[model samples]
Target: MTRLYNDPQAFADEMIDGFVAANSRWVRRVSGGVVRATRTEPGTVAVVVGGGSGHYPAFGGLVGRGLAHGAAMGNLFASPSAQQVHTVAATAHRGAGVLFSYGNYAGDVLHFDQAQERLRAEGIECRTVRVTDDISSAPADRADQRRGIAGDLTVFKVAGAAADAGYDLDGVVRVAERANERTRSFGVAFSGCTLPGADAPLFTVPEGRMGVGMGIHGEPGIHEADVPSADGLAELLVSSLLGEVPQSVDTVRGARVGVILNGLGSVKYEELFVVYRRVAQLLAEAELEVVDPEVGELVTSFDMAGVSLTLFWLDDELERLWGAPCDTPAYRKGALEPAELIDDTELAAETAAEIPPATAASRQVADVAVAALATMSRTIDEHVDELGRMDAIAGDGDHGIGMQRGVHAAVDAARAAHAAQAGAGTVLALAGDAWADRAGGTSGALWGAILRAVATEVGDERVPDAAALARGMRAATDAVLRFGAVVGDKTMVDALVPFADELETAVGDGAGITAAWARAADAAAAAAAASADLMPRMGRARPHAEKSLGTPDPGAHSFALLMRAVLTTTTNGRNAS
Candidate 1:
């Protein structure tokens, strides 16, 4: 359990500040995260890696020479916002380009891809190589769908080394892909992790039992079994990985590999050493040569009592890169020449965008929008724990906190835009940006898309009507569908699509906006409730589908709740404007 925290919502930001202050020599403060304080070679490709905040050394800790040039740190258990990623990449880019790498998760994919598009639009070359090295997340035939784990170290190390060795964008991507293809990892959990201020752990394992193939994010494991002795546990981990060796490696005999016995958190070094002790014997027995093996925490999941084993199969080039001298806040290796520190220390954050002019009617609608946003903030605050409890059934248990962060930011932005005399559309759009930027996860991105899509339909000059809102809802549904989740995927799409369809149908039937919206909210609520029976086919919960069978998806439930909450606020005949 996490004991020390001032504001749970402020934990990630506070932690980053303290970390930067302590590691100023290796990393300097940037808007999104830390960039290497040490100067890099001109024209070197900047390797920017990131994900959620709970994983130490994985993201921020790896920023230094011969590793990630910068890392975009997000809230705990949330992916960094697209704005954050773009900011870090822009700052880190030397002259060659930027290579983005991180664990293969849905939120990370969405935000990082968005950032990549933005960078390319500005003529800064950007490429991404998602780390899909966790063997337990997916089947061998569908390896690309695997989520990354401790194997992230191998990919990042090789990418950083290749970038520093003067590889261009293409060359860096190629080597990074090579490293990803050659790595495999498996993990087990003896206990669940507790988020700060949470009443209980995300998911608890039975006493004397261990969860096999557990995710680093407190996702329940594929199976559970009686905990075994250290040697027995090592045998299980080693044999499991050995059975699923990468296709590139024809055989395990005589293959040189880089091994990492990573503690997920709360697993002390001595325990990890005991497990690695037997892991080493097993690898040697299988005739594999180990090089530069790491036996400590690299990637962690807060206080999860879990450990993962990663085997990075190394060819000649990869071996040299793995052995390259490097320095970072964490995970320093062989000595290196003194690095020059960067001179410019100023960090000017971009402020709220200027508000566009609005018509009187539109400004009236903007006032209503601001009020609706406030209602949403209050609604989320009231039901945050309920939403989080639902998500914790099969997720990392951060849904409540993520929503709290997003809705609060949305409310703040909407209030600011209203004060600036912005239109309803402009206010919602700005609020949406803040929601996504502050929340930094799947829910955040979806809400942002939904708001922006709705904003486009009701421009600055027009007062939003029933038809416009129905159309906006349809467009929002389309935006979500583009992310590849369907109605039965046990995601927000399950509730949102039904609500949009119901709204359009009701409005087309000449029903008033109030009636149509209420009807749509009812439909959404039903869909969200029925989601309790559907297996999760998307996002982090997919790995623990069985565990979610009787629970509604947190995303779907939250969307439904938010819809209902907004409906109540717009009760002046539901056009509100």
Candidate 2:
């Protein structure tokens, strides 16, 4: 359990500040994450890697001379926002291009892809390689769906080495893909982790029991069994991984591989060595040659009692790349010559702000938006515990915390916009950016898109009426669907679609905005409850879809809750007027 934190909401940001202060030689603080303090060749390809913050050495620690040029660290167990990714990439990109790499999670994919599109639009060459190496998450035929675990180190190392060796963007991408294809990993957990200020673990294992195929984000395992001895556990991981060597390698026998015996937070190094002893013996008995072996924490969940093993199959070229020198804050290999550092003044420039023009009438409506946002924040705060409990059933238990952070930020932004005499559309747009930028997850991205769609439909040209409100709701639904989910996918879109349809119908039948919203809110509540019967087809919950069968999706439930809360606020305001 995390015993120390000043404020739960400010944990990630504060942690980054302390890390930059401690590792001044290796990295400097950037807005989203950190970039290498040392300078690189001007036209070299830049390799940027990152994910959620709890995975320490993985992201920020790996930023230095022969590893990632920068990392866009996100909130705990969440992916960085697209805006965050774009900002870090822009700061890191020197001249040639940029290569973005990270775990194959839903939020990371969405944000990184969006950032890649944005960079290309501005004439900066950008590419991505998502590490899919956890064999237990998906079947052999669906390798693309496997989650990236500790094997992330292998892919990131190779990609960074390729970039450091002066490979172009295409060449670096090719090597990164090959590394991901060859790497395989499996893990187990004895117990789950607790976030700061949380009273309980995200999920728990029974006494003397262990979870097999557990994820790093405190997600429960696919199966549970009695705990095995160190040797027995070693055999479990080794045999399972050897059974699925990549098709490129004919067999594990006589093949050379790089191995990482990674500790997932609470597990001590001495216990890891005990397990590794058996692991090394077994690999030798199987006639496999192990190259440079690493045994320690590389990627980690906050205080998780678990460990993972990764095998990276290597050919001659891959061997050379794997052996390349790197000097990061946490992980270091062979020595390298000293490099020049980036100037402080040039790196301190922040992202440029945008203020769209607005009309006088729309500014009055902005005040109303501010009130709605404040009410939404209070509602989310009230239900945070319930939302976290629901998410822990089949996903990472951070939904409640993420939503609270996002809504609080949105409320603050809306209040500031109202004070500035901004229009309704501008206020909504600014609030959307704040929510996505601070929340940094799948929910954050989807909600940000919904807000932006509504903002576009409610421009400052005129006063927004029921017809305009219906149109904005419709646009929000469409934007969510096109972003990555549909009604049956068991996401917020399930509730949102029903709410939008009912609202449009009510307004068409001559109902006022408040009445239409109330009716739509009821529809959303029903849709959210009905989602319990569904099996998730997308996002992190997909791998454990069966486990989520009897529970409502946290995303859908929160959306419905927000709808009902907004309806009450709007209806009360109308009655008073």
Candidate 3:
């Protein structure tokens, strides 16, 4: 049913055409499908890299200012031919010479070796660096036999920096080899990817099972295990990496380390953070000093569900290189800073003391709010079909499902807090935990943070009047805006901005809490309705801004409903009193 090209040769050519077209500033195709980018410092030692084509940014995207000078691109899952590698090396070679680097795959080795010989015969000096970091691909004693994973980034950066520093060809090759020696990576796949127009996936795994040691190109993993929670997954990955590194308190006492939490594809950033939280704790337990941690979709397989961890043991020189100023379309290394020394005991104590206690009245409010939210949760779930359909027109379809999960978790936590007779702050804390656990998206996390901010503002208040409510709303709005840059950009702000404004107006008019809430709810609903004609300017939908026109944002609609429920409840309570 797919209209995309099924032929690997055709697909590869088309992809390379599009890639070169979009990235002319950084890359261009040379003879034999070799994409080469001009070096930032011409006449410096050149780094030529390559791998299969499907891994977009890898090998290809790395060819830029502070990374590889040339990339030999191949067909999806297939290595570039010897001519491709030779052409890339020839194009990238400076008078200083060229260093060839690539993952440790049979075909890559064979092709790159052939290219190396060809380049040498042409009177161009050349050497090679192979990355073998995937522990799953080889035995502990044979780690050098494993295929490369995400650690390719480290090799490229280190080698590129060495070359930029005026290292000769052999010296640059040594730096790259050292990077490959010190760096390690491992990955697990939750799902497989489809190859272009293939009717079936390139490979298949059982449902709810994760393929450990899965190759990025759909090769069989070591084994499939039952899917684990994000925390569990992080633990698994951290344990494996730690085993390889074998850190002792003494070994890590004064050492700085770089931790990279990379998503394969389709794994949400929120989920990645959850994994990072656990990984951070694990590293701390091992007493390894974390220098700069990066978490995101750095290397991806097309639509595959998986994540990989890359650990680079940092030395003073490597640290300097890692922190060196470099810029590319996908990666940028900001200015470097000295690692801060943190006392573990002090950190633990501070965290414990910062958690505020919850009160009885706060628990009551939380209980009622939870029940109301739970009832609304079903509404969110039911509307998911519609929401996903709407989102598919302009953005990803997870918005509705993400919200439903988040609201349900928040309600559930509120119920638990109420049963435990938690104080106001504690109830809010519980709500935050629930939000983080269930929301699994940027908006959900933003909403959760907003709730926690409001709870912190309200504190132990037994009865929040119009002024207090207004202050709380203002705090919540500020928190959301701080967490995400979507406010005033046609996101939930379409409804929330009006709700806060109406609340302020009501309070200024000397309206009671109930009346003010009612006014705010009406304004929020009206604003949400009005947003149907506005264009989205934030989030993933922003890129397709025109497509979202004439449709109300799901976030705005949800905000309006929440305000309506709160207003209705407040009015009923006032009338009963």
RMSD to truth, every model: 1.5, 1.3, 23.1
Q: Could you estimate the TM-score for every candidate?
A: 0.97, 0.98, 0.56
Candidate number with greatest lDDT = 1
Which pairs of residues collide in candidate 1?
Answer: none
What's the candidate order when arranged by decreasing lDDT? 1, 2, 3
Q: Which parts of model 3 have CA positions greater than 4 angstroms off?
A: 1-8, 33-42, 246-250, 335-577
Candidate with more favorable, higher lDDT: 2 or 3: 2
236: Cα error in model 3, Å = 0.6
Q: Model 3 over residues 1-577: C-alpha lDDT tens digits? A: 2256755325767887777778766666675453334434457887888876667577677766666777887655556656567767776676778888888765577567767878888888888889887877767676666778788888888888788778787888776777788887889998777656544454566999998977676555667899998889989998888777733223755567888898887689999999999999988888888877889876677667889998888877787777666555467676423223222232111122134455556656665555555656766766756665555444544455556656776777877776666655566666765664345344555566667776776665474566877888888778666544554476787788788888989999998877888899899989887877878755546535676788888778777877776665555552211
Candidate 1 worst ten-residue window by lDDT: 343-352
In candidate 3, where is summed lDDT lowest over 10 consecutive residues? 344-353
Best of the two (1, 2) by TM-score? 2
Deviation in angstroms for 43 in model 2?
1.3
